[model samples]
Target: MTDDADESSTSLLPEPLRTVTPLTGSHRDESMDVIGWGIFLGLVVLLLPLLPFILIVWLISKVTESLTPS
Candidate 1:
């Protein structure tokens, strides 16, 4: 059937995402900026998820410390 032929032809086609250019020259400088931002962003993202847990733990310790008589 023509449907089978079309499927086969489409399967043989290369994906369009293979045309990536390597970083070089000023592009390399821009890439380093991007990498720096990426790392910073990753750290912020990681911290955000832990922030609430950290705050809760701090609050619990403070409350317990106040309640405990010396």
Candidate 2:
């Protein structure tokens, strides 16, 4: 009964892995910076066409508000 209790209290991990060091950095690759910028620029390029549409909608709303009675 005591042996069963002792076994249950013991750790499941191996002895070497019982202690672990804290992480200080992700060690990301330098080339990844270019990829990140590329993705950001690609999103900007995709959204550029929508910018004109958004401006048109905003202008139409302003014109409608000005024409409405107070």
Candidate 3:
């Protein structure tokens, strides 16, 4: 009949999935955003050029393997 009863029923849920508090802006999240973007961009810069060579090598391997007798 009350919100307490509703909450008691929801206790069956996992603790992490339960809404314990309202979301708030976190400095740690903001710092992580900066670091995440840096790592993402670093990976992009490092891998973008390698992608073509990787694909070419992969294609060549597949072609050679297919051409070779089983």
Candidate 4:
């Protein structure tokens, strides 16, 4: 009975994880950087068409902020 209880208790505990692989490479780092920059530039490019709208909104917000009392 004691052995069964101990076995059950041990079974209830979580198992330890196996070893994990680490990343190490200049080419990988460069590719990742390129991907990151591409994503960033893509976002900027996508937002390019909305730049004027963003500027207008910003100007309106600033004007409102200036006109409103604190």
| Reference-based TM-score of each model | 0.49, 0.56, 0.55, 0.50
Candidate 2's C-alpha runs over 4 A off are 7-32
Candidate 3: tens digits of C-alpha lDDT, residues 1-70: 7999988988775566657888888546788899999999999999999999999999999999999998
lDDT of 4: 0.91
Q: Give the higher-lDDT candidate: 1 or 4.
A: 4
Q: Scored by Cα lDDT, where does model 2 land?
A: 0.91
List the global CA lDDT of all models: 0.89, 0.91, 0.90, 0.91
Minimum summed lDDT over a 10-residue window in model 3 is located at 11-20
Candidate ranking (TM-score, best to worst): 2, 3, 4, 1
| Residue 58 local lDDT, model 1 | 100
Q: Go through the candidates in order and give the C-alpha RMSD of each one to the true structure.
A: 9.4, 4.5, 10.5, 5.9
Query: Candidate 1: deviation at residue 59, Å?
Result: 0.1
Question: Measured by TM-score, how close is model 3 to the native structure?
Answer: 0.55
Compared to the true structure, candidate 4 yields what TM-score?
Answer: 0.50
Tens-digit lDDT track of model 4 for 42-65:
999999999999999999999999
